[model samples]
Target chain A: MNDHSTPILASQGTPCLLVDEERMERNIARLRDRLRAAEVAFRPHLKTAKSWEVSRLLMTTPQGPATVSTLREAEELAAHGVKDITYAVGISPDKLTRVQKLRAGGIALTILLDSVEQALAVAKASDPKDPIPVLIELDCDGHRSGVKPQDATLLAAIAQALAPRARLEGVLTHAGESYEARGSEALSAAAEQERAAAVMAAETLRAKGWPCPVVSVGSTPTAFSAQSYAGVTEVRAGVFVFFDLVQAGIGICTQDDIALSVLTTVIGHQREKGWTIVDAGWTALSCDRGTATQNVDQGYGLVCDLEGRPITNLIVTIVNQEHGIVAARQGTPRSDQEFPIGTRLRILPSHACATATQHDRYHVIGAGQSDVTAVWPRFTGW
Target chain B: MNDHSTPILASQGTPCLLVDEERMERNIARLRDRLRAAEVAFRPHLKTAKSWEVSRLLMTTPQGPATVSTLREAEELAAHGVKDITYAVGISPDKLTRVQKLRAGGIALTILLDSVEQALAVAKASDPKDPIPVLIELDCDGHRSGVKPQDATLLAAIAQALAPRARLEGVLTHAGESYEARGSEALSAAAEQERAAAVMAAETLRAKGWPCPVVSVGSTPTAFSAQSYAGVTEVRAGVFVFFDLVQAGIGICTQDDIALSVLTTVIGHQREKGWTIVDAGWTALSCDRGTATQNVDQGYGLVCDLEGRPITNLIVTIVNQEHGIVAARQGTPRSDQEFPIGTRLRILPSHACATATQHDRYHVIGAGQSDVTAVWPRFTGW
Candidate 1:
């Protein structure tokens, strides 16, 4: 942002991703400290900050105890020397070869499943000497894919199907519904429900004589608001690595805690309408309107100065593929002189996970420093 | 899809992009024939399918007379032997160096701008011996950036500012508002308005002694619905290469005309809730709900079979980071046996440009063939 030999954002070009390392480290520490106090293992989901530099910082060790949404992330992390990972998404038969390859490459990778069909597929794919680790996903508040926590019959059947061929690691449940919970009490209740559901499912598997060792429960909101981890062994949460407007809207993190933003340059303006057009549209900031249903809708994103300070009442109201129209939140006409052409601005995203996927690298602005000190690369795809 | 020894899709992986070559070629022909009959030169926008293979098919020749939204696209096209390109987005001062570099590399990359500020920047950056070509943008409808078509004073000022230093190529206008025009009559009216605005701006510059030779006007909706391209010299439209649900909803194309889709594999199901979860979520399919306001709100996207046939009333109702919940439009409970785990499916996108941005490569199915014949790589970022 300031002079070294050159201006940081100016040299990098507009409409690019920026990571405030200071804020990101703080976010990482906050979660680490919280989980440590709760006595639960913290396996940060690497889907948000897909960069190896960021992943290395988030993991408990260089060998990891990390969570990934895809096998691609697991492979990339493994290349960076991360040995332990959990592919948290429910397993499908097609991805097992990649899982087997990762395991063959000396990485301890685990897969998740809910149905007996998936259990049998994992069993078929596993080698008896190095049986693939499996987790039975439990439904926490019925938000998404998972076997209902009370479905003891399905749990026992899946566990029995994995016997001798695949190691039944434990049960994992995500408090995805926790994202919709409002206020502290509601968030706390959602967290408790997630914790209880995972414990109950693990107990269900254990009652049937399966060694269900892990009880995993998480979602950014629940991870921060949970009253207790109780019987949970580990927690997995993404988005928190780069808390976004959606998180701020959900009371999971404050606006100042957000570490990621899209740097842009104002290119044109419609004076009468008070709309300042910037070069960072959906292609740069992503088309996630996650805050639209929140108590206060942050349309597209909140506009900020080059220093990443939010401009009061300013947000991106509309976006084309390569252009964003920024206007006052109240729709009041603003003088074109305020955001003249070539003025540099940054936009905080509506959803970090969605927005981060738009770019392949992050220009890291060092902690308390203006200059960009590092560039961390990221990857996408299965 | 059936002939390959190793099953094309089975080997590639799920949540990948698929381009039906037959459908895409038809889409391209439909637009080309329409613009040709209208007597306007087609300069297809390459922002939707940012692949060299697709660009080669869209361009008039390998040395193209093409349109691009970003300089990155321009450079990529140039690398693929495309010589003539119009960077359709409003240019900023920071990008001037790149424009100079592209020109130095023997690529004729023209830039767009609308104000005296931008004109001065261009003139300053331009070498008098090899002047930078500039196009003054005119606002067809109060949709996005550009100077008002009737703003004669500003138009004259910008033209004067570019005199002798920069080449004022002509005027360009995009009927972005056409995306909201519901009926055929409304779309045709929007096209007329766009042509009128561009022609008016070109005439305005010409009256002031500027040689405004080119008058470019287009938008996907207007490009196909235009009853007349009377004063427009060239037509520029993206997304027509792979018409999406939004285009179909607008009555510009039918659902069968959509050529892009996300291939996914069902991973889990909630039978009682009627949810069949797949591995393609917002990350793979994009979070563009462009059809939400249409007559038929195609929730995330219209669910399709592996062969590209839309399953009756089925759509991706909800999406997480790496999970999409497919369900019937009527919300009736479905049996888990209907979409058993591991079942392969394809989902048509709500917006092709947004959806295409999520992946790096397109697995192309040859014309009238089920087998994936090629993998065209794509690049992203500024």
Candidate 2:
């Protein structure tokens, strides 16, 4: 009744996060099927989609193998019956207590460590209790973290220092540079780099008398590119659930794979200047300038109609706390490209993780208005 | 013992949101002091802090004036005994049901409208119900919404047509462009523009025989700059409760006025590259590219030590979902800059409102760490 009679448009709303439940299920099912075809164990990171509801949907088994950033996530998922968890952060000194508590909870906690200092902290903490099993993080192509795979002596030193007190489980590496890849070839090359790094680190740990059972390597882009897990024990990825503009830009997924989006209402229009303001600002769609530095900077996010097609040369130029100015990307502002007042639009998030943090709940929609499956509430507490 | 002996840090752990209760008290006192000095009615916007506890502090009386962005905020504040409320959004047809319900609940509700079509919609909706008082949002700057002051006749016509079914309350405006102010002069200019536009609009409305009562003009930056509210009846400002880096960058408030910050721990260090990665990423601090184009672009936010002094030439660059990399802004990499594992650091928010939406609760810290008052939860459903 409010002017937007489009068959695909939902009722006008602002500051709302929408999860196309059908698309989300398809995205998850596709990835799980792919990992099944590759015969690789998929331990999806809970950090991307923090919802237990989404996590429950993605998993096929009762004891879901998961990847986590904080002890909070591990504890939350662990409490929800998600066992076989990998706390995929370099364990800090202060968090030892929480880590110990998590370990004592009969949760299979696998903490990642890079240096001897952290190894000492975890080793001593585990000795008084039980062996805190840990995976030695190896530096891949991206020089973010990890003991360099070639630095096998340092790995042996760390393993020697902690092996008696803590269990040296395996080696893991993330092909983060694959996010920077433009196509499948670059993603494949990045995957190769990741595999080689983890394999080399595991071999070094094994030769040096450290048990390296798990060799984990995965990124969404690389999961498909190099599926032959030669030395890899498991593949971990989180973004495969809700593909973003970044994932689509990397050619890892299509636009249809982007299951989540921000549902916004067009507030007003500056017809002369060729800009329309929406109620969903950075508070709804996060200010992640993801893929902004890429060849084509998807400013803020990709603007789509209810049907979800990219409106090229259109950019969310400016954003206040609760207002986004959707304007022409660069040149002359066209007057014809105007959505009247109170029009509903959906914006594709640059990164699913950043955008998901903005809203507290997601409205799971089937196809149109009559197909609203349910309203799933997601918890966001640090 | 933790490597870093910062006992004052978060026990649940580092890299979370901290709310200084004392600072919050002082901030509220300052706003009250400012209102007393200016002799103007103050309506604190709940969109800034979004905390019921903070709202209770602001409410000197049960019938305190407040502005909210969502229906949830209005209903919550109403339940908390706040009577005079302004639903500060371009009202949509779908939310009119809630508005009617709110009006029926005996809470004084004022809505914002711009164009004639919207005015007509509101007029038609309030048929069985009494005419609702409406505030015409005046466009002081070409920032977001509202009609310009010069277009007063069109505004008068719209007011006249809707006056039969809706009460034209008065003129109201927000100088959102004040955030872009370089100094006090620019801020004052923006404030003057805001005041003048609303005053002119009020004059135009009054000249046409409308009994306009409230002439409201506000915005955090403008409220800081403008004085002598000759025609203005009330001022609304949020974000002053927790001043952020954007507020500091504009030369409005000092770093000390900032009451909220993200508590982050040094998780990993690339010592060779001189980069220290923190656990708080775009998810914690918000991804606002705040005022970056204007002279000084804060990459994510200003990185500060525990005491809140800027780490000169160091900025957080390339943020993923839950990872923020701190690197030297200018000089070559230095070894001393690389923090050891588990070093706790406070991160300044670019925009307090945007940053606040990331967290569910604020860990209220008192005079010091030993006096941890309590955790204040916020409402985030819409």
Candidate 3:
């Protein structure tokens, strides 16, 4: 299905998501190789790519399982023969029916639980004959959802609640705080903190006579920065497959490493203001200003040429629902002659996950080629 | 097809869009009645709703033409028998083929052009037997794309280039700056500026012996704030159909007038920080912080009860891709007990256009009723 040819802009519509297949493969290989070297299982998070084609490339095994943010993704991935899927988000009672359906379909879908209430709910809903597997979410850095590893009483209570109807499979944690890490030192510390927390939670359960086999920990930033994964059995990270500006700004990846971009056409120009209006806007690129807090703020995204090369300091300064205003950064010359009306440009997003969700499909282009090799469909919604 | 019933949260997925049909109808009726009283055509922009059902409700004449942001929308609306449609975004050369196809299908699709280059391109590609119709885009506020109203040379050149092949239908302008209006006085002035600019462009065309019949002027703020239409024929506004927090902050609509919201379920809580995490996040509510600069900054969105009544001072403060953090505004009681896990809440979005674009379908509930009356599908992408 992967066909390579010369770049053809007219065939693909403007403001569509384009993925550099070669760069994407390199990214996958980097992570896959790193995890293999570290003797850790790589469970790629499907929330970022959300494409069956991309998932197939990421999987080491034919029917390998992955982590998904929503039941919709789990159902879609499972239908495509992905077994042992993990619904990473804390399972709400209302979604249990869908979970039951997926589990009954011969898919070993693992649910995440942080509270005793959630554990009891899962236990009540699970079939005793076919007990459900669950991973206890531990909060390492307190950035988002998860229980604290030190809360033994709460952890033991949750594990006991799931005794017969459900199994406490292991412990998992995400160092979302790793996103705030400044440099290599901070990033490594955050990674170690995440690893330690998950291992601590697993050990806590094991000490209580629970068979906690899994110790999963990850975050794109921490996963790449971690020096060791001694006690961690597996690591999960999504955005690494298509690094964005936020990742670049954090010194994790370079702008050239970004595999995804929004292909846009220059519609008009605001000459005096030094703004080149493009068809790609917030709706196309997404309203993710993740780089705003970073050392360098790319208003919306970094502007690049048709060949996916960054156009020096030009960046999208403003965006409406359907219009993006590209301008040169301060001290950079406004190269109006370089980009006139009808010029097609690529914009590297600040957050790959947010930008990718805006489009229904990705136009895959091989490296050194322009023609779309494959059109990968991505499904959205809860 | 509208059915009414009891409020059942479990059947519908969490973080799904919920449209209050009665509120939407009232909003539509108010705008329609206003435009009718003023003796002007009401061509509602379908960019916000993007639903055939909503477009059907907005049209005064059944299967009537409407304004759209993309060719995809025009195709969808045209397929549903909406004949005279206008693709509001500036026409690109690559999209001209699709425009021709839509025109060939018996749909009078009007294109928007602001440059002589574009006019010449359209003219060159046009079928002499059936020329494409275009509206000269006029810059009223310089907030986005358009040729300045006083740029007579450019306007005349475009008209001359479009002569034998493509016909210049009229002139249109949007007062996007009206979004920055502080109060009634500022809003009216912005509206007047939009009216004068569009009329001036139309007059400029007529003076050059060009037949400029249509003079369109609008924006949600200007459409409601304008005192007179004078030389304008039709008004185009979309978000007015589902007023949002940004509209309310601009004093254009009240919170009660917001017809669209994200129905989310509470998944967990951070009691010490007074944060209630919900399933609705940027993917559900959108990453639009439009009201951040407004007088009242409604974080991500205003939180409401299941019946769509705003819970005083509660708002969504932070959001990840799939998790929204709802918190009480300063000085308001932390009421953690009020919103426990599994509790359903409705969140009013900052921008209806941005938020609605995230969902595939909207679960609609009639006013004063809890049960979803219908499920309306909305299409996105260009």
Go through the candidates in order and give each one's C-alpha lDDT. Answer: 0.89, 0.79, 0.89
Q: Would you give me the overall lDDT of model 2?
A: 0.79
- lDDT string, candidate 1, B1-382, tens digits: 2232236664568889999999999999988887777677999999998999998888877898899999999988888888999999999988999999999999988899988999998999899989999999989898888889999999999988887889999999999989899898999999899989998888888887888989998899999888887778999998999999999999999999999999899998887887899999999988999998888889889998777889888889898899999988754444344877777888999999999999999999875435789899986887
> How far off is residue A68 in model 3, in Å?
0.7
User: Over the stretch A1-382, how does candidate 1's per-residue lDDT look in tens digits?
Assistant: 2233246555668899999999999999999999998788999999998889999889988898999999889999999899999999999898888899999999999999999999998998889999999999998898898899999999999998998889999999998888789999999999999999999988888888998998888889999989988889999998999999999998989999999999899899887787899999999988899998998788999998887889888899898899999988754545344877888888999999988999999999975435788888897777
Interface RMSD of 3: 1.0
Model 2 misplaced stretches (Cα beyond 4 Å) = A1-9, A127-129, A309-315, A331-338, A367-370, B1-10, B127-129, B307-313, B331-338
Per-model fnat list: 0.91, 0.57, 0.59
A best-first ranking of the candidates according to their lDDT comes to 3, 1, 2
lDDT of 2 by residue, A1-382 (tens): 3343443346635668878887888888887888788787888877877888888887666578888877778877888987788988788877778877877888888898898988888888885458988888888976477888999788998898786889888998988888877776777788888998999889988887777999998888888688467777789888878888888877888877898888777776666567788887777777777777676667778787765566766767777666788876656355367677677777888888888888777777776532346777665665
- After superposition, the stretches of candidate 1 with alpha carbons farther than 4 Å from their true spots are A1-6, A331-337, B1-6, B330-337
What candidate 2 keeps of the native contacts, as a fraction, is 0.57
Instruction: Spell out the clash pairs found in candidate 1.
Output: B1-B370, B1-B371
Chain B vs. true chain B: TM-score per candidate: 0.96, 0.94, 0.97
Predictions ranked by TM-score, top down? 3, 1, 2
Tens-digit lDDT track of model 3 for A1-382: 0123244753577989999999899999999999999999988998999989999998887587588999999999888999978889888888899999998999999999888888899999999998999999988998988888998888899999988899899998999989999999999999999998888888888899998999988899999999999989899999999999999999888888899999999888768888888999988999999988887888899998888889878899888989999998656787665465677889999899999999999999976647787899997787
Candidate 2 chain A, poorest ten consecutive residues by summed lDDT:
A1-10
DockQ of each: 0.86, 0.58, 0.72
Clashes of 1: 2
- The 10-residue segment with the lowest total lDDT in model 3 chain B: B1-10
The per-residue C-alpha lDDT of model 2 at residue A120 equals 88
Fnat of model 3, as a fraction: 0.59
